[model samples]
Target: MTASVLSRAGADLSTARESLARAAQRVEDLLGALPVPGLRSLEQRDRAAAAHNEVRAHRVDFMATHATEVYDELTGGRTRDLRLDELVEAAAGAFPGLVPTAGQLAVERSRAQADKEGREIDQGIFLRGVLRCDLAGPHLLTAMLRPTTRALLLLPDFQRTGLIEMEAVRLERRDGVARLTMCRQDCLNAEDERQVDDMETAVDLALLDPAVRVGLIRGGEMTHPRYQGRRVFSAGINLKKLSAGEIPLVGFLLRRELGYLHKIRRGLCPREPEQWHAPYLDKPWVGAIDTFAIGGGTQLALLFDHVIAASDAYFSLPAAREGIIPGVANLRFTRIAGARLSRQVILQGRRILATDPEAHLLVDEVVEPAAMDDAVERALTRLDGAAVVANRRMVNFAEESLADFRAYVGEFTVQQALRIYGEDVIDKVDRFSGRSE
Candidate 1:
């Protein structure tokens, strides 16, 4: 990672510079008008610009410094005469990834490639020397297939983001066991649209990896704005970068490899024998979902069996909040909380207070912020042997008795979500965006 080579990669970035700027400007505008009583007068625009530029600056530094190391790995040769243009044509389709074939592949002899070779190749192609760190392995190996640490994780920060700071995942060692902690900032914690996606992808990949055991998540409130100044916009969420980086791949890998979801039997509804008992009667796992467990965050939490929650963790069926409801989340919530709690969860915009006794019904333990981490540790500590498993099975079988309580009469409601993103939503966006109609 030297200064000369990073300069070349930095050159490939002229195209994305402007996009980075607009995204930052829009964020500053929205933060200015937030409903917070004392925040109104704060000039966050400058800070936003600085943060945005910091990421961009890091990109320039990486390009000038790390480019040679990047190129050498991409276009290694017996002759140390490989030029940037030669490397581009040699590894065109896979300039930033790995070799199509395995070790010690031949390099394309020669070609005078164009300056902007981006359109000449597909985005998914591998570069000759990019290293993908193998987390599951005992020994560390770096090659052309993928990147390790900063190269893969911090590349975007170097490219689109303008700053770099410590982003070490907190690992606490207790009784020889290591637990990972995820922290949350009081305000929305995204720099640009690109990093938002990158961080999410990195977290998703890191957590689901079998190498990780218990994941401690504290805050996860990610929001994006379209514009600012006089008008405001909340175009919901932007799943582009996040999705592109393979967020869903984590879930797919979990189910395919782990058989993580254990299906539960629906008990008989006393009167309607064929009808399943309680709403969560026939789900794969048991867990509590609360406090804005909408979007990908909520979806991932459901993948776990025992969910610890805060009363304020408001869970919402955001499908309607968008434009559709595949009834996917319902497939689980209906059974666990039974029909009654499930109905209230979706049909009514309700916040299942974690402090409330009702939260304990869904989760194993419900405690205040200070005690939540302790409760999770206790749950894990006692899980060392077979007794916990035996008790879990016993409790699950007993849960079958609650199937009769799943019934309730009501239609699904979309008013709150609608209000959040309705004409008012568009108006706030357009007004701030200076695109008001």
Candidate 2:
């Protein structure tokens, strides 16, 4: 039923695969052993077929087992109960505060969507044309059953990196107006700063890129409605299965300029934010599709100018309890939520005013979950296609005025590394150089 069970059974194919691989190597070995040209005859055809079937067995085992694993793993092990009915109910449910930002929920929805696509493809009868191999019609049929499988095979390594690289952001220009379209829904919404940064980078791509005019974001019930609203523009951060490194990576990449990174590993900030040279900030119509904008997620949503949310969006900041303060979006939250709500947010480190009208200001509009795309399109209608290019001069000046980023980070890194080392760096170097310990 699960890939785990199949994998064990598939172990037979592993041995068969290895044997076939060795069989190729042993053609010479057999020549050496027999002291003759080799065995000949009609058995050669059966032999080749056996080898091909061995390869096929391995391939089938690998494809089926791996695909099932992908589903289970990406589904957070909930694939056991993953049914179409549950997916639809969850998508339509009024959920807010369960996740911090729409980005996280967006990922969940994407998975659900993929699952639906797979089921539909499975049920369809005429999808055989696109199949690559008919030897195992089931494999071909399953490929049809899961259209996203092709996409998965194309970018087979995405499972490791936890990133979804979009070839193009959907944009529609109709009647001299521009609107964004939705891509496939599966997502990895990470609350980590680095993942937050990746999402931010994507936002700039979606909203500001001349190549993309609009993007439809999907979200989860867990996000703050304020941030979740941004799912209208793009996928928000999803915290599901995100590691600690990923959490800060999301925020750091989004907020900090990568130019600020230290040449040496700096211990000062949690991580370095990636710098993007491409111009996107000047665009006034940058939009967000956020889910679970808690802590870092909320920070990411604030980075965008436009946000569309479901009725169930939620918001909060919990970095205070972690003994480190959030430097990224708390500055903006403090201004918008005021001193009191901000205090409760950081100090209490829990959901406070997620459903309140006060949080509504963080987003431009609120709508039923189904109407999220409509809301985003409606907002895009008011834009004049103006972008802020003049600010580049000011940005250049600002960069020039700032302290040398490398040195600034290097100094802190040296101090902290030396501090943590106590006497280790010098001692190690000196010892390496044959000096006293």
Among the numbered candidates, top lDDT falls to 2
Candidate 1 ranges beyond 4 A from true positions: 1-212, 220-297, 311-313, 318-327, 355-358, 384-437
True lDDT of residue 425, candidate 2? 30
TM-score of 1: 0.35
List per-prediction Cα lDDT, in the order shown. 0.33, 0.36
Candidate 1 C-alpha lDDT tens digits along 88-127: 3454343322111111112110211111111111111111
Task: Give one digit per residue, the lDDT tens place, for model 2 in 218-334.
Answer: 433323344433442223233232211122211242123221111001111111144244311233343444344555446545644466666665666655443334443444567
For each of the candidates, give the backbone clash count. 51, 68
Q: Model 2: residues >4 Å from true position, as ranges?
A: 1-188, 192-281, 286-291, 321-323, 350-354, 387-437
* Cα-based lDDT at residue 404, candidate 1: 24
After TM-score superposition, the amount by which residue 134's alpha carbon in candidate 2 deviates from its true location, in angstroms, is 66
Model 2 has an lDDT value of 0.36
